[model samples]
Target: MSKKPVKKQDPETTGHSWDGIEEFNNPLPRWWLWTLYACIIWGIGYSIAYPAWPLINGATRGVLGYSTRAEVAEDIAYFKAANADLREELVAADLSEVANNPELLHFANANGRAVFATWCSQCHGSGAAGAVGFPNLLDNDWLWGGEIEEINETVTVGVRNETNDDARYSEMPAFGDILEEEEIAQVTEFVLSLSDDDVDQTMALAGATVFADNCAACHGEEGLGDKSQGAPNLADAIWLYGGDRETIMQTVTNSRFGVMPAWNARLSESDIRAVAIYVHGLGGGE
Candidate 1:
């Protein structure tokens, strides 16, 4: 018997055609269709179980009650609980006692650095070096005393702040109104001489009498500054405003009155102590 050739079957069409090309009416595979349906069902189930829809006032609260904010709050609570003991000890202990304990000191310094970056870096530079008007914490110069107790007091009460009754207060008279331009120039030269900067000896000599009569009550006779009066030392090269002749003239003529806010009302007692320790350890504290 001879082998017969197999006949080819024609594929079905959609009864539509364009320019002699016919459209095929092919059915999708059953497995692929089922998979697509399964995905749709899963998406619907997820929408019902969790927050999905948005309303005018807020978002949907699904049956599962899942919330990102609640989870974050729980994490914060856990962290605070874990560090409660150390935080409590830091709050209760004296600043010196905190410094004596190596572990506590380390913790305070680390926290203080973070606090300084957040709160103080705006005025004092990130390095605590300070700017033109701000006082540098890294040097030995201090308008107020630099001891831990003193630093704490200054930070708590602040300088020239009206809100705090115990704030460090001082007033520099604007000599532009009191004295003539010639007298102001004489005093500027005298201020420069205190720092051992080269100046006209004759002018400085004349200003020495003027200084003794007017400025010595606040600035010591030697220009070493009186911490009690919050007067800055004129003898030191460190100038809060500037060391140049023009700047000195300006200071003498107009005077300088800078203000620092009291931190006691803004920060907790523990936070104030920590910052004091951090500032004191910056190689300047007495």
Candidate 2:
């Protein structure tokens, strides 16, 4: 066999050891060094092109002078242009006229339906069947009024709020303070009897006396609610508060007041009209 020589190791790190292991200093990879340099150059270019510098008044206007708000406005303008005819048709047509015109009605209803879902659906249900304190928009019985113009007014100016100047306002006094429990019970029975013909005639007769004295001034002798007073007709099955005996008792004890929010500030005129039309189309269009 021929003899072979062993290669010698470098001596600068010969004495350095970590549990008998030695370390070597290596230069960074060429690709990594270039990548770092490229990042620094890209940052400088980006800062120059965009509004990166902050001043006392605002940010600097870059060479492009582009703005996010301007871009948004341009986008909105484009969308409006594309849908101009539909918007115009809705704006020009009276809500009742729109209902008669199938195409315009469709356009208005679609937009109005969407807005109602966003704003009004929370109080008035998705189906427009209102809750305990809210009147059902789907029903013909209207407290404030159900005409398209009236609905539009309600939409523009909400009820019982300082912000709404012409807000619908009415209040029924709490009879609990004035009337005895027996008297309240009699009134509750009377209110229910107005709807049900099958009610106990004897009890109803007795309740009628109480109704004549306490309720006839607001709710007519026939139980036809006074719109001017915002008193709902007791003869109808549609109860704003509720129809149950317990709920009716509660209403008689302590009157209820419902509120509808103003959509004028939150929505455009066209949008408010659209919702009124859609709600009218829901079956309460008067």
Candidate 3:
């Protein structure tokens, strides 16, 4: 049998050329053209059905009202609802006695770690060994009280924050304006002498008098610090900002005002209690 002869059409080209290479004016394949059209139609449909257009404040809520955040919220709500009974029991139970109940202790430890990792880990590290400005939760050196009740209250209300009405509040006088530079330096020396074995004996002696007159009212005469006034113990080697002579001088001059957010505004009562229990048991609490 004889095969039919193939037709040879002249090649088409656009007016564009680069050296000897001519631009072929070829049409896209039929399947490829159809796929492109389908994609365009799908994109339009998707935009209409879901949030796509950007607005001044936020994205447009599409006709379907599909929101990833909303879905996530719903999922969270479902899980929260599932744990409602345990949470209610936790909230009702006294935090001091939380460890007595194995179920409650187990639940608190498990959930508290999760909550701490999510919220507390940013400031306090994942291991709860805080950064320069942040206090280490693992240590016994707490600015505020370290009892289970105290921890719960601190976590709930926070320290030096404006949001919570019952927040732990204290103000260290900016000695830069109040005292002379030499006085500030002397007091800083005395403060250093509390923890550091090597200190200027003469300057520290002079600072003893200055500390009794100005700082003793809050920091105490012995430099052990007043927990009632939220004053940190300077007698110990654990320093919040730093233990260096330069850092001590700066602290004495300017004063440190660290702010912590009130978890009560963001977290549930049970969650706060759980975290408090978790922190208290971390070999730090009194």
Best by lDDT: 3
Q: Please, what are the lDDT tens digits per residue for candidate 1 over residues 70-163? A: 9999996897688677778988897877778998899788777877888888998999999999989888788888888898899899999999
Tens-digit per-residue lDDT, 1-286, candidate 3: 9989989985799878899889889988999999999999999999999999999999988899999999999999998898888899999998888889998899998889999999999999999999999999998877778899999999999989999999999989888989998988888888889988799989998998889888998988899998889998889988899989999888888999999999999998999998998988888878
**Candidate 1: what lDDT?**
0.88
Q: lDDT: which is higher, 1 or 2?
A: 1
Cα RMSDs, all models: 6.7, 5.9, 3.6
Clashes, model 3: 0
TM-score of 1: 0.75
Q: Which lDDT tens digits does candidate 2 get at residues 1-286?
A: 9878888766555456898899665567999999999999998888788778899999977778878889999997997788788887787776666767887788788888998899988988999988877768987798778988888887889887677777888888889988889888877777778777766667678888989998899889999989877788889788876798889888888777666676787898778888888888898847
Compared to the true structure, candidate 3 yields what TM-score?
0.85
Candidate ranking (TM-score, best to worst): 3, 1, 2
TM-score: which candidate is best?
A: 3
Off by over 4 Å in 3: 1-10, 18-21
